[model samples]
Target chain A: MPRLSADQRHCVRLTLNGRAVEGEAEPRMLLTDFLRHVIGATGTHVGCEHGVCGACTIEIDGALARACLTLAVQADGTSVRTVEGLAPEPGRLSVLQAAFRRHHALQCGFCTPGILMSLDHYLRSHPLPTETDVREFLGGHLCRCTGYVPIIAAALDAAERLRNGETDA
Target chain B: MKPARFDYVRADSLAEVHDVLAAECGEAAVIAGGQSLVPLLSMRMARPKVVLDIMRIPELAGISLDGDTIRVGAAVRQAELLAWSQLKARQPLLALTLPWVGHAQTRARGTVCGSVALADPSAEIPLTLLALRGEVELSTKAGRRRVAAEDFFQGLMSTARADDELIEAIRFPCGRPGEGHAFREFARRHGDFAIVACAAVADGKGVRLAVGGVADRPVARTFAGLGGSMLGQALDAFAHELEAREDLHATAAYRRELVRQLGRQVIEEARRCRA
Candidate 1:
């Protein structure tokens, strides 16, 4: 592995999914890269790299952020959750992931991880966002396929399910 | 693409950021929220050798009121500022334009100072701030200084912020009881950068019009206590003064028309808001 040069390393310590983690990351290394490469969580995908597409989204300190644009050093002392650690049990999906599958929310699946991350944060904050609100909240994620009609439905369905005490995935 | 390698220094204090900038001279760029800077760096558009991260800086973070002025710390995120009730009432211009900012996810991390400092002509807060006659407080290791929003924006992606200084805060002058402001914009898609935007402030005497994204910088002109036919003539003259750039988003002519339309609409809305 090619280590970040001495000058690029910023000593940072943070908690990742209930575990204390400390490392030196390049100032240039994106938070997505830090999570995937250094911390060994590869579920976070990088899609537009710019903040426009939400493919690289992650939850940092309980807020969704574009991991591709966020510097690793910026996450120092912060708690982060990647899609890989979203659920503990093997052969099972989180409610959102299962919802996406159940409602056919994804087609190509390239944009699913980011959509999942953004919707996770959105549903947590707004357990029951109206259709218009859900449309606006998920506006950042750009899905090249599926036309977003089903994705919108899935989000609404997931919200309804969650509010009705359905957590099984 | 990833950003070029640079040493990141997290400043715990405003003085520390200023000192670091002073030491690095023009080599350092302040990162507050990193919404604008991150893209600029990744695209290699801006290559500052030293990264002075100021999001952690204590002094540049929050929204407060000071002597009838709504003072917003530079590092205060747009979402946080929009959530304030007093900011909503005292600065309705900001509140109305807040939702148009990049969706909830982007607003969560984008800073007010980052938006103003980036000075993107199409951005919402800068033009609204300019129309509202906002003031930017800049601090350097040498001392502190203030610049009116009109003078602060130099041109496209430019501001009066010196290399050795950090934008400390922005002050929106509290509107008098009868004064009113209205902002309107047209974009290809919701939350996308505005193709053309207009912000208007109306007082008893006259209305002031400011248009963004139609020009390289936010341009303003006063109606000079005029309305009816005279107001229409002033708007036409102001539309001609616009220097619009033709980009993939909109043609210069289209943007100029947008400026004219939005300017006219905002003036009408401001009048109604006043009434």
Candidate 2:
């Protein structure tokens, strides 16, 4: 029953990457901007604020969503996961991240964070994925660098490693 | 690009939504998935004075079978609807077209009714609905009414929904015992908007074909057991009747050609399975 007016900022609270965080944002603020500028978790990159590029992809309440397409106030009371949450520990690479490193999946790393979030969520639900499935899922993302072949290789390799019970590298 | 400033409201009940909507009149935009609306907002193409988030309303969030109709709630995400166990069995047309609605990432959050509300000329859902003879349930504070899919879409990116009305649900009829349905789309990328999309439904007596991305709105026509070159002629007439225009992705001639070629393929596929 609360109407958060556009001209004023309101306190928006949500769980971010396992930690409870709150930020003040106007009703027009995008989740991506709130995450980077207000909460200071810049791991989630923003590209094509209109949601074409998947650089702004993240998990909202365990569902894959484009941060650029979601409003900050709409995320209130929900739990969000970003690329910063992918690692098991500081300085430790998750299996998917390790595979990307091994395959040299990234060139400039501008799109790596969002790609990691997507592959991480996808491989969890579909533990055993075919090469074609990986390619189809990757269609959501646009990577100008590496031409996506290495990214596909890394995703498949990570799926194999995870299926074999390897947690980290 | 950043969106123009707008007020926000998280409504927990239909009454609250109706109140704000009725008060704001035409200046309020309802956000349910934000997949299509968000882009319009960021581009400043649609600058609503206030955005009412309707997903929080518990009543608007489910899919159920009411007799032969699958009533899909406004809050039901596209992925959730596709994952319904009874989907492919009951509504094969939707099961086939839902995957082509958007990418897995976008479908994970985009709602089925949101796509209907957006009413893109080339959207798979609208075309499929019209092909299936589905209906859209629109509601306001006073009451609700059902509009047949054919009447719901007025033109490109337009619908008959009033300013105070919210799309409560969409009713997709369950497939009949002996009917057959098929869908085909051509897009440069898998998730991009289609250059041309077709949906066909065939019965023992006749076949209904719906074409999108060619005109102001999706167009459906019925053909009665036309064979070979006759069917081709009907398709040619439909293609030319659409007055296909040249866009950056395709030429008018190319779209007309697709209509001729793809049109015949869907009609053939649908008729082939009609038992």
Candidate 3:
């Protein structure tokens, strides 16, 4: 009902990674910036601020979305999950992360966080993914290194591991 | 890449939205899903004094079957529509094209009406709307009106919609007997914007083919009772008439060739699927 002005910051509250967090952001501030600068959750990286690159992907209310394409003011009161939530606990990795490590899916690791977020969401709905399906799904992401071969291998291995109830790493 | 400063308003009701739009007139921009607008904003291509949010309004959500047509509300997300169990049975063309609209990540948040409202020449949603001859329900301070898809899309990123108007919902007709719908797009990447996208509706009378991404707007032509060679010549004429220009991604000759080849292939597929 009330319009939040541009000169002042508005209070935005949302649950992040199973915990409630609050921050103040301008209406023009992107959700990616708010997550990193305001919420201090740097695990969600920013690449190609116009949403072409998938480096800023995250789970918004259980749905995969581009953080660069969402306004922080719009994310208010929503539950969000970043790459930080992927690990089961401190110093531990999820099944997908372990598979990526074993297969060397990432190099330089600039685009790893967003890739991990997307693969994590996809593998849940599609427990059994063929090589073609994995390849097509990875079209949303761009990774200069690994040539996408090892990433595809890692994704399939992670899917099989999850199917076998392998949860911790 | 931050957007310029603007005041944000989240409306809870249609009356509130009307008030805000009536007061601001043409200086406000409506936000829904934000798949396209956000990118433009980040690039500083689109700037407005006020950004209005309509997703909170109860009147702007839900999907319902109204007799022979399926009505998708303005706030209905693309993923929700793609997941609808009755989609294939009701609007098979939409079912075939929704997956091509964007990636799973973007589709999870983008709205159906939002796609039509943006009127992207290379987008799947508007192309499907035109292919099926569907309509979008427009709302403004003056009242509600329905505009046919053909007239709704004017030119490159232009539409008949007014600055103060909002696309309330989009109506897609249900699939009928003896009719088959097929969609094909040739993009460099699966989820990228199309270089040439074609959708064909084949029925008893003739086949209506709609082509996108090669022109400033999606265009459709009906070829009735044409033989193989005649159809090929007609397709060639349509391709040449579009006058597709050269862009960094493709050449004019290459695009016309895709239109000629992909268009004929899609038409055949639609005819084969016709019951």
Who wins the DockQ comparison?
A: 2
lDDT by candidate, in order shown: 0.84, 0.93, 0.91
> lDDT per residue, candidate 2, A13-103, as tens digits?
9999899999999999999999999999999999889888899999999999999999999999999999999998998999999999999
Q: Which stretches of candidate 2 lie over 4 Å from their true place?
A: none
Ranking of predictions according to TM-score: 2, 3, 1
Deviation in Å, model 1, residue B253 alpha carbon? 1.0
TM-score for each candidate, following the candidate numbering: 0.95, 0.99, 0.98
User: What is candidate 3's lDDT per residue for B132-246, written digit by digit as tens?
Assistant: 9999898887899999999999988889888778889999888889988888999988999998899999998889999989888899988896778999999999999986857
Candidate order by decreasing DockQ: 2, 3, 1
- Give DockQ: model 1: 0.46
Question: Which model scores highest in lDDT?
Answer: 2
Off by over 4 Å in 1: A1-10
Per residue, candidate 3 scores C-alpha lDDT tens digits across A23-103 of: 999999999999999999999999898777899999999999999999999999999999999999999999999999999
lDDT of residue A40 for candidate 3? 97
Interface RMSD of candidate 3? 0.8
Model 1, B214-266: lDDT tens digits are: 88888877786777888777888888888888999889989888877888899
